[model samples]
Target: MERDALLQVANFSTLFACMVLKFPQILVLMRARSTAGVSLNSLVLELAGFIVFVSYQMYYDYPPPTYLEYPILIAQDVILLLLILHYNGNMKQSIFYAAVFIGGWKLLTVEKRVIDLAMSLCTFISASSKLAQLQCLWATKDSSRVSALSWGLATYTCLARIYTTVVMTGDVQVLVRFVAMTILNFWVTATAMYYKPSAKKKD
Candidate 1:
Protein backbone atom coordinates (compact mmCIF):
# COMPACT_ATOMS: atom_id res chain seq x y z
CA MET A 1 0.00 0.00 0.00
CA GLU A 2 2.76 2.41 0.88
CA ARG A 3 4.67 1.62 -2.29
CA ASP A 4 1.57 2.05 -4.38
CA ALA A 5 0.89 5.44 -2.83
CA LEU A 6 4.44 6.57 -3.47
CA LEU A 7 4.20 5.46 -7.07
CA GLN A 8 1.00 7.41 -7.58
CA VAL A 9 2.54 10.56 -6.20
CA ALA A 10 5.64 10.21 -8.30
CA ASN A 11 3.68 9.47 -11.44
CA PHE A 12 1.34 12.41 -11.01
CA SER A 13 4.19 14.72 -10.08
CA THR A 14 6.09 13.78 -13.19
CA LEU A 15 3.01 14.29 -15.31
CA PHE A 16 2.39 17.72 -13.86
CA ALA A 17 5.98 18.77 -14.31
CA CYS A 18 6.07 17.61 -17.92
CA MET A 19 2.92 19.51 -18.78
CA VAL A 20 4.80 22.78 -18.41
CA LEU A 21 8.33 21.53 -18.92
CA LYS A 22 9.08 23.86 -21.80
CA PHE A 23 7.04 26.87 -20.80
CA PRO A 24 9.89 28.73 -19.21
CA GLN A 25 12.00 28.34 -22.29
CA ILE A 26 9.11 29.26 -24.52
CA LEU A 27 8.30 32.34 -22.50
CA VAL A 28 11.93 33.38 -22.44
CA LEU A 29 12.14 33.19 -26.21
CA MET A 30 8.91 35.12 -26.66
CA ARG A 31 9.91 37.86 -24.27
CA ALA A 32 13.41 38.22 -25.58
CA ARG A 33 12.53 37.59 -29.23
CA SER A 34 15.63 35.52 -29.62
CA THR A 35 16.89 31.95 -29.58
CA ALA A 36 20.32 33.09 -28.54
CA GLY A 37 21.35 30.40 -26.08
CA VAL A 38 18.94 27.68 -27.11
CA SER A 39 19.89 24.80 -29.37
CA LEU A 40 17.65 23.90 -32.29
CA ASN A 41 19.43 20.56 -32.59
CA SER A 42 18.66 19.76 -28.99
CA LEU A 43 14.95 20.40 -29.42
CA VAL A 44 14.83 18.28 -32.59
CA LEU A 45 16.69 15.36 -31.07
CA GLU A 46 14.70 15.55 -27.88
CA LEU A 47 11.47 15.40 -29.87
CA ALA A 48 12.74 12.30 -31.63
CA GLY A 49 13.57 10.71 -28.30
CA PHE A 50 10.10 11.43 -26.93
CA ILE A 51 8.45 9.90 -29.99
CA VAL A 52 10.48 6.71 -29.75
CA PHE A 53 9.93 6.35 -26.03
CA VAL A 54 6.17 6.83 -26.16
CA SER A 55 5.96 4.53 -29.14
CA TYR A 56 7.93 1.88 -27.29
CA GLN A 57 5.66 2.13 -24.27
CA MET A 58 2.56 1.82 -26.42
CA TYR A 59 3.95 -1.08 -28.47
CA TYR A 60 4.72 -3.08 -25.35
CA ASP A 61 1.48 -2.10 -23.59
CA TYR A 62 3.29 -0.53 -20.69
CA PRO A 63 1.12 1.05 -17.97
CA PRO A 64 -0.35 4.36 -19.05
CA PRO A 65 0.86 6.07 -15.92
CA THR A 66 4.40 5.09 -16.66
CA TYR A 67 4.55 6.96 -19.94
CA LEU A 68 1.59 9.30 -19.87
CA GLU A 69 3.70 12.41 -19.53
CA TYR A 70 5.53 11.71 -22.81
CA PRO A 71 2.67 12.81 -25.03
CA ILE A 72 2.32 16.07 -23.13
CA LEU A 73 6.06 16.59 -23.27
CA ILE A 74 6.02 15.95 -27.01
CA ALA A 75 3.31 18.53 -27.55
CA GLN A 76 5.23 21.09 -25.56
CA ASP A 77 8.35 20.28 -27.54
CA VAL A 78 6.50 20.83 -30.81
CA ILE A 79 5.40 24.28 -29.65
CA LEU A 80 8.92 25.06 -28.54
CA LEU A 81 10.33 23.88 -31.88
CA LEU A 82 7.91 26.07 -33.78
CA LEU A 83 8.78 29.05 -31.64
CA ILE A 84 12.50 28.44 -32.13
CA LEU A 85 12.08 28.25 -35.88
CA HIS A 86 9.97 31.37 -35.89
CA TYR A 87 12.56 33.31 -33.94
CA ASN A 88 15.34 32.06 -36.19
CA GLY A 89 13.36 33.17 -39.26
CA ASN A 90 13.36 29.60 -40.54
CA MET A 91 9.71 28.84 -40.07
CA LYS A 92 9.56 27.59 -43.65
CA GLN A 93 11.61 24.56 -42.63
CA SER A 94 8.93 23.56 -40.12
CA ILE A 95 7.02 21.65 -42.78
CA PHE A 96 10.00 19.53 -43.73
CA TYR A 97 10.87 18.82 -40.11
CA ALA A 98 7.30 17.92 -39.28
CA ALA A 99 7.09 15.50 -42.21
CA VAL A 100 10.32 13.81 -41.16
CA PHE A 101 9.27 13.51 -37.53
CA ILE A 102 5.84 12.19 -38.41
CA GLY A 103 7.28 9.68 -40.84
CA GLY A 104 9.83 8.54 -38.30
CA TRP A 105 7.14 8.13 -35.65
CA LYS A 106 5.07 5.88 -37.85
CA LEU A 107 8.04 3.80 -38.94
CA LEU A 108 9.20 3.02 -35.45
CA THR A 109 6.35 0.63 -34.73
CA VAL A 110 6.13 -1.13 -38.08
CA GLU A 111 7.98 -4.12 -36.60
CA LYS A 112 8.88 -5.29 -33.15
CA ARG A 113 12.57 -5.23 -33.94
CA VAL A 114 12.34 -1.70 -35.25
CA ILE A 115 10.99 -0.33 -32.00
CA ASP A 116 13.42 -2.39 -30.00
CA LEU A 117 16.22 -0.90 -32.03
CA ALA A 118 14.80 2.57 -31.60
CA MET A 119 14.42 2.14 -27.86
CA SER A 120 17.98 0.92 -27.67
CA LEU A 121 19.05 4.13 -29.36
CA CYS A 122 16.63 6.36 -27.49
CA THR A 123 19.04 7.00 -24.63
CA PHE A 124 21.77 8.10 -26.96
CA ILE A 125 19.37 10.28 -28.90
CA SER A 126 18.13 11.92 -25.75
CA ALA A 127 21.62 12.29 -24.31
CA SER A 128 22.81 13.85 -27.52
CA SER A 129 20.01 16.38 -27.22
CA LYS A 130 21.23 17.47 -23.82
CA LEU A 131 24.79 17.53 -25.04
CA ALA A 132 23.70 19.75 -27.87
CA GLN A 133 22.25 22.19 -25.37
CA LEU A 134 25.46 22.06 -23.39
CA GLN A 135 27.41 22.84 -26.52
CA CYS A 136 25.14 25.83 -27.18
CA LEU A 137 25.77 27.12 -23.68
CA TRP A 138 29.50 26.59 -24.07
CA ALA A 139 29.58 28.39 -27.38
CA THR A 140 27.52 31.35 -26.22
CA LYS A 141 28.95 31.47 -22.69
CA ASP A 142 25.76 33.26 -21.67
CA SER A 143 22.74 31.46 -20.33
CA SER A 144 20.75 34.58 -19.58
CA ARG A 145 18.21 33.47 -22.11
CA VAL A 146 18.51 29.73 -21.54
CA SER A 147 15.86 29.30 -18.81
CA ALA A 148 17.64 27.42 -16.09
CA LEU A 149 14.20 27.00 -14.55
CA SER A 150 13.16 24.81 -17.43
CA TRP A 151 16.22 22.59 -17.08
CA GLY A 152 15.82 22.47 -13.33
CA LEU A 153 12.21 21.39 -13.68
CA ALA A 154 13.33 18.79 -16.21
CA THR A 155 15.78 17.41 -13.68
CA TYR A 156 12.96 16.99 -11.18
CA THR A 157 10.71 15.21 -13.65
CA CYS A 158 13.50 12.83 -14.64
CA LEU A 159 14.19 12.04 -11.01
CA ALA A 160 10.52 11.43 -10.34
CA ARG A 161 10.26 9.20 -13.40
CA ILE A 162 13.20 7.14 -12.22
CA TYR A 163 11.39 6.29 -9.01
CA THR A 164 8.16 5.58 -10.84
CA THR A 165 9.90 3.40 -13.42
CA VAL A 166 11.44 1.23 -10.74
CA VAL A 167 8.24 0.85 -8.79
CA MET A 168 5.94 0.33 -11.76
CA THR A 169 7.69 -1.17 -14.80
CA GLY A 170 11.14 -2.34 -13.76
CA ASP A 171 12.13 -2.08 -17.40
CA VAL A 172 15.88 -1.82 -17.63
CA GLN A 173 15.78 0.28 -20.79
CA VAL A 174 13.39 2.81 -19.29
CA LEU A 175 15.34 2.91 -16.04
CA VAL A 176 18.58 3.52 -17.87
CA ARG A 177 17.03 6.28 -19.93
CA PHE A 178 15.67 8.07 -16.88
CA VAL A 179 18.94 7.74 -14.98
CA ALA A 180 20.94 9.18 -17.86
CA MET A 181 18.39 11.93 -18.34
CA THR A 182 18.50 12.85 -14.69
CA ILE A 183 22.26 13.29 -14.76
CA LEU A 184 22.23 15.22 -18.01
CA ASN A 185 19.38 17.43 -16.88
CA PHE A 186 21.23 18.24 -13.68
CA TRP A 187 24.38 19.00 -15.65
CA VAL A 188 22.48 21.33 -17.94
CA THR A 189 20.84 23.08 -15.02
CA ALA A 190 24.17 23.65 -13.30
CA THR A 191 25.80 24.79 -16.52
CA ALA A 192 23.00 27.22 -17.21
CA MET A 193 23.23 28.66 -13.73
CA TYR A 194 26.96 28.92 -13.95
CA TYR A 195 26.79 30.85 -17.19
CA LYS A 196 24.16 33.33 -16.08
CA PRO A 197 25.26 36.93 -16.56
CA SER A 198 24.56 37.63 -12.92
CA ALA A 199 26.92 34.84 -11.90
CA LYS A 200 29.60 36.29 -14.12
CA LYS A 201 28.95 39.78 -12.84
CA LYS A 202 29.40 38.60 -9.27
CA ASP A 203 32.73 36.99 -10.08
Candidate 2:
Protein backbone atom coordinates (compact mmCIF):
# COMPACT_ATOMS: atom_id res chain seq x y z
CA MET A 1 0.00 0.00 0.00
CA GLU A 2 2.84 2.37 0.82
CA ARG A 3 4.59 1.64 -2.44
CA ASP A 4 1.39 2.22 -4.38
CA ALA A 5 0.86 5.48 -2.58
CA LEU A 6 4.33 6.67 -3.45
CA LEU A 7 3.79 5.73 -7.06
CA GLN A 8 0.55 7.64 -7.10
CA VAL A 9 2.19 10.67 -5.56
CA ALA A 10 5.04 10.62 -8.01
CA ASN A 11 2.78 10.15 -11.02
CA PHE A 12 0.37 12.85 -9.96
CA SER A 13 3.14 15.23 -9.01
CA THR A 14 4.75 14.82 -12.42
CA LEU A 15 1.41 15.31 -14.13
CA PHE A 16 0.65 18.46 -12.20
CA ALA A 17 4.09 19.90 -12.83
CA CYS A 18 3.98 19.11 -16.54
CA MET A 19 0.54 20.66 -16.79
CA VAL A 20 2.14 24.03 -16.21
CA LEU A 21 5.65 23.28 -17.39
CA LYS A 22 5.59 25.73 -20.27
CA PHE A 23 3.22 28.30 -18.84
CA PRO A 24 5.93 30.45 -17.29
CA GLN A 25 7.82 30.65 -20.57
CA ILE A 26 4.63 31.33 -22.45
CA LEU A 27 3.54 34.04 -20.06
CA VAL A 28 6.97 35.61 -20.10
CA LEU A 29 6.95 35.78 -23.88
CA MET A 30 3.44 37.18 -24.09
CA ARG A 31 3.95 39.78 -21.40
CA ALA A 32 7.26 40.87 -22.80
CA ARG A 33 5.94 40.73 -26.36
CA SER A 34 9.24 39.26 -27.41
CA THR A 35 11.05 35.99 -27.90
CA ALA A 36 14.26 37.37 -26.53
CA GLY A 37 16.41 34.71 -24.85
CA VAL A 38 14.00 32.07 -26.12
CA SER A 39 15.28 29.49 -28.58
CA LEU A 40 12.98 28.45 -31.39
CA ASN A 41 15.25 25.55 -32.28
CA SER A 42 15.10 24.36 -28.73
CA LEU A 43 11.31 24.45 -28.66
CA VAL A 44 11.06 22.57 -31.96
CA LEU A 45 13.54 19.95 -30.89
CA GLU A 46 11.87 19.57 -27.51
CA LEU A 47 8.50 19.16 -29.18
CA ALA A 48 9.90 16.50 -31.46
CA GLY A 49 11.41 14.60 -28.55
CA PHE A 50 8.12 14.76 -26.65
CA ILE A 51 6.26 13.37 -29.65
CA VAL A 52 8.68 10.50 -30.07
CA PHE A 53 8.69 9.58 -26.42
CA VAL A 54 4.93 9.65 -26.13
CA SER A 55 4.50 7.70 -29.32
CA TYR A 56 6.89 5.05 -28.08
CA GLN A 57 5.02 4.76 -24.79
CA MET A 58 1.69 4.44 -26.57
CA TYR A 59 3.08 2.01 -29.07
CA TYR A 60 4.24 -0.27 -26.30
CA ASP A 61 1.00 0.12 -24.33
CA TYR A 62 2.73 1.19 -21.14
CA PRO A 63 0.63 2.20 -18.15
CA PRO A 64 -1.19 5.45 -18.80
CA PRO A 65 -0.16 7.16 -15.58
CA THR A 66 3.52 6.73 -16.33
CA TYR A 67 3.25 8.90 -19.42
CA LEU A 68 -0.03 10.75 -19.03
CA GLU A 69 1.84 14.01 -18.57
CA TYR A 70 3.33 13.84 -22.06
CA PRO A 71 0.22 14.85 -23.93
CA ILE A 72 -0.20 17.82 -21.64
CA LEU A 73 3.45 18.67 -22.11
CA ILE A 74 3.09 18.35 -25.86
CA ALA A 75 0.08 20.63 -25.97
CA GLN A 76 1.87 23.20 -23.88
CA ASP A 77 4.91 23.00 -26.14
CA VAL A 78 2.76 23.53 -29.21
CA ILE A 79 1.28 26.64 -27.69
CA LEU A 80 4.69 27.90 -26.69
CA LEU A 81 6.09 27.17 -30.13
CA LEU A 82 3.31 29.07 -31.84
CA LEU A 83 3.82 32.02 -29.55
CA ILE A 84 7.53 32.12 -30.33
CA LEU A 85 6.94 31.89 -34.05
CA HIS A 86 4.28 34.55 -33.95
CA TYR A 87 6.47 36.89 -31.99
CA ASN A 88 9.36 36.23 -34.36
CA GLY A 89 7.17 36.83 -37.42
CA ASN A 90 7.60 33.26 -38.60
CA MET A 91 4.00 32.14 -38.21
CA LYS A 92 3.93 30.84 -41.76
CA GLN A 93 6.55 28.25 -40.91
CA SER A 94 4.24 26.69 -38.36
CA ILE A 95 2.33 24.87 -41.07
CA PHE A 96 5.48 23.17 -42.27
CA TYR A 97 6.48 22.23 -38.78
CA ALA A 98 3.03 20.86 -38.03
CA ALA A 99 3.02 18.73 -41.13
CA VAL A 100 6.45 17.32 -40.42
CA PHE A 101 5.55 16.50 -36.84
CA ILE A 102 2.36 14.75 -37.86
CA GLY A 103 4.09 12.76 -40.54
CA GLY A 104 6.92 11.77 -38.23
CA TRP A 105 4.43 10.66 -35.59
CA LYS A 106 2.78 8.29 -38.03
CA LEU A 107 6.08 6.89 -39.23
CA LEU A 108 7.64 6.32 -35.82
CA THR A 109 5.22 3.55 -34.87
CA VAL A 110 4.97 1.88 -38.23
CA GLU A 111 7.35 -0.80 -37.02
CA LYS A 112 8.73 -1.99 -33.72
CA ARG A 113 12.26 -1.44 -34.88
CA VAL A 114 11.47 2.13 -35.90
CA ILE A 115 10.07 3.02 -32.50
CA ASP A 116 12.92 1.25 -30.77
CA LEU A 117 15.44 3.17 -32.82
CA ALA A 118 13.76 6.42 -32.04
CA MET A 119 13.69 5.55 -28.36
CA SER A 120 17.35 4.68 -28.48
CA LEU A 121 18.18 8.10 -29.81
CA CYS A 122 15.58 9.92 -27.74
CA THR A 123 17.90 10.80 -24.89
CA PHE A 124 20.29 12.53 -27.21
CA ILE A 125 17.50 14.30 -29.04
CA SER A 126 16.01 15.54 -25.80
CA ALA A 127 19.42 16.54 -24.50
CA SER A 128 20.07 18.47 -27.68
CA SER A 129 16.91 20.45 -27.04
CA LYS A 130 18.26 21.59 -23.71
CA LEU A 131 21.66 22.27 -25.18
CA ALA A 132 20.05 24.42 -27.85
CA GLN A 133 18.47 26.53 -25.15
CA LEU A 134 21.78 26.74 -23.35
CA GLN A 135 23.43 27.88 -26.54
CA CYS A 136 20.83 30.60 -26.85
CA LEU A 137 21.53 31.83 -23.33
CA TRP A 138 25.26 31.67 -24.00
CA ALA A 139 24.89 33.70 -27.17
CA THR A 140 22.66 36.37 -25.67
CA LYS A 141 23.89 36.31 -22.07
CA ASP A 142 20.39 37.43 -21.29
CA SER A 143 17.50 35.29 -20.18
CA SER A 144 15.08 38.18 -20.33
CA ARG A 145 12.13 36.25 -21.72
CA VAL A 146 13.25 32.83 -20.62
CA SER A 147 11.52 31.54 -17.54
CA ALA A 148 13.76 29.98 -14.96
CA LEU A 149 10.62 28.97 -13.10
CA SER A 150 9.50 26.83 -15.99
CA TRP A 151 12.85 25.08 -16.23
CA GLY A 152 12.86 24.53 -12.47
CA LEU A 153 9.41 22.99 -12.74
CA ALA A 154 10.64 20.80 -15.56
CA THR A 155 13.49 19.61 -13.40
CA TYR A 156 10.97 18.67 -10.72
CA THR A 157 8.84 16.72 -13.17
CA CYS A 158 11.82 14.83 -14.53
CA LEU A 159 12.96 13.96 -11.02
CA ALA A 160 9.47 12.81 -10.14
CA ARG A 161 9.37 10.63 -13.22
CA ILE A 162 12.74 9.14 -12.29
CA TYR A 163 10.93 7.82 -9.26
CA THR A 164 7.71 6.83 -11.00
CA THR A 165 9.40 5.17 -13.94
CA VAL A 166 11.46 2.97 -11.67
CA VAL A 167 8.38 2.08 -9.62
CA MET A 168 5.88 1.52 -12.41
CA THR A 169 7.48 0.82 -15.77
CA GLY A 170 10.96 -0.66 -15.26
CA ASP A 171 11.52 0.22 -18.88
CA VAL A 172 15.14 1.10 -19.47
CA GLN A 173 14.40 3.56 -22.22
CA VAL A 174 11.97 5.45 -20.06
CA LEU A 175 14.31 5.34 -17.10
CA VAL A 176 17.30 6.61 -19.05
CA ARG A 177 15.29 9.38 -20.65
CA PHE A 178 14.02 10.63 -17.30
CA VAL A 179 17.47 10.46 -15.77
CA ALA A 180 19.06 12.41 -18.60
CA MET A 181 16.20 14.91 -18.66
CA THR A 182 16.46 15.49 -14.93
CA ILE A 183 20.07 16.52 -15.24
CA LEU A 184 19.53 18.66 -18.31
CA ASN A 185 16.46 20.38 -16.87
CA PHE A 186 18.34 21.32 -13.73
CA TRP A 187 21.23 22.63 -15.79
CA VAL A 188 18.83 24.73 -17.83
CA THR A 189 17.22 26.15 -14.70
CA ALA A 190 20.62 27.11 -13.34
CA THR A 191 21.75 28.63 -16.60
CA ALA A 192 18.58 30.61 -17.08
CA MET A 193 18.74 31.95 -13.55
CA TYR A 194 22.37 32.89 -14.03
CA TYR A 195 21.63 34.80 -17.20
CA LYS A 196 18.44 36.41 -15.95
CA PRO A 197 18.65 40.11 -16.69
CA SER A 198 17.58 41.01 -13.19
CA ALA A 199 20.42 38.97 -11.82
CA LYS A 200 22.83 40.72 -14.17
CA LYS A 201 21.47 44.18 -13.32
CA LYS A 202 21.86 43.55 -9.61
CA ASP A 203 25.42 42.40 -10.19
Clashing pairs for model 2 are none
* Candidate 1 C-alpha lDDT tens digits along 3-78: 8898888988888888888899889889999888899999999999999999999999999998898899999999
For model 2, residues 1-203, the per-residue Cα lDDT tens digits are 99989888888888888888889888899999998788889998899999999999899898999889999999999999899889889999999999999999999999999999999998999999999999999999999899999999999988988888888778888898889998998998999988876787563
Off by over 4 Å in 1: 201-203
Q: Model 2's lDDT to the true fold?
A: 0.90
**Native RMSD of candidate 2 (Å):** 1.1
TM per candidate comes to: 0.98, 0.97
Give the whole-model CA lDDT for all candidates, comma-separated.
Answer: 0.93, 0.90
Compared to the true structure, candidate 1 yields what TM-score? 0.98
The ten-residue window of minimal lDDT in model 2 covers 194-203
